[model samples]
Target: MAEKYCVENLAVSVLDNLRYQHDWTELQILTHSPVDDLPLPRPLISGLPPRRLYLHPDDQIEMLKSHPNPEGSIPETPVTEWVLPVHLAEKWTLKAFASVFDSMPPENSASPHRVKRVLLATVHDDSTVVYYFMHDGIVKPRQN
Candidate 1:
């Protein structure tokens, strides 16, 4: 149907932007939820960012404690993240987001305690894509 085509187009656009514009690697479009093998509301993009997008405050503290010079000595490994693609015009709600979160694949074993989050990639009419971080629950604000 037309709706499915539109959704696929949006997802491809977002994926292209992330791969070509943002330098993300290991990108793929996921149609089914890895958790239950059920179809997702929309396609999701999974990829590893060029750099670490977020670091938990506790993790940062631990890293500092372990490293003598925390400035550039600590290596920041980029973790694979789930990306939900949508049109800027689509209506979004908490329940909708919760469904997406509940269907997500488990996080990488390297950081089992890390919070579940997604990059909400919203594509505008003008071919621009904006990304925002959406956490499943409230996360402590990053320390400056």
Candidate 2:
């Protein structure tokens, strides 16, 4: 069966709630195409945040390594995640999700080429996890 709606529209559909419920001033439509290069047909979106939303974990480690503190206790930085608002009723599939992922720039701006943020969306119920892959300058995964 053909999907009724695309990912970009689904994202905006949720954004409508962000506008009305949170009363966030200055909501802006960012992009509608996939953040990178996949096939979903909704607009990808972003707003110039009231404040920066998330921080990547690897970036935190790098920062801690760089800090000149004598103790070097490894200051905690929040695992980077985008703070996007989403609803429970709406349905999404992989194709739709790929669109969103394709739109984002892999590396973030904080460390020039060391930082990156991936979208971490939650349903209104706050139970299910929908993860997307994001990269900044190719990182080696830690061995368990």
Which prediction has the highest TM-score against the true structure? 1
Q: In candidate 1, what are the lDDT values of residues 1-144, reduced to their tens digit?
A: 124238888889988999999999999999997656899877899999999987767677788788877566568789887889988788788998988887777775465343378999988889988889898888787665
Please write out the lDDT profile of model 2 over residues 25-59, one tens digit for every residue: 45554443223454324444444434434434565
Which residue ranges in model 1 land beyond 4 Å of their true spot?
1-5, 71-73, 109-115
Tell me each candidate's RMSD, in Å, in order.
Answer: 2.8, 6.7
In candidate 1, position 42 carries an lDDT of 72
The TM-score measured for candidate 1 stands at 0.86
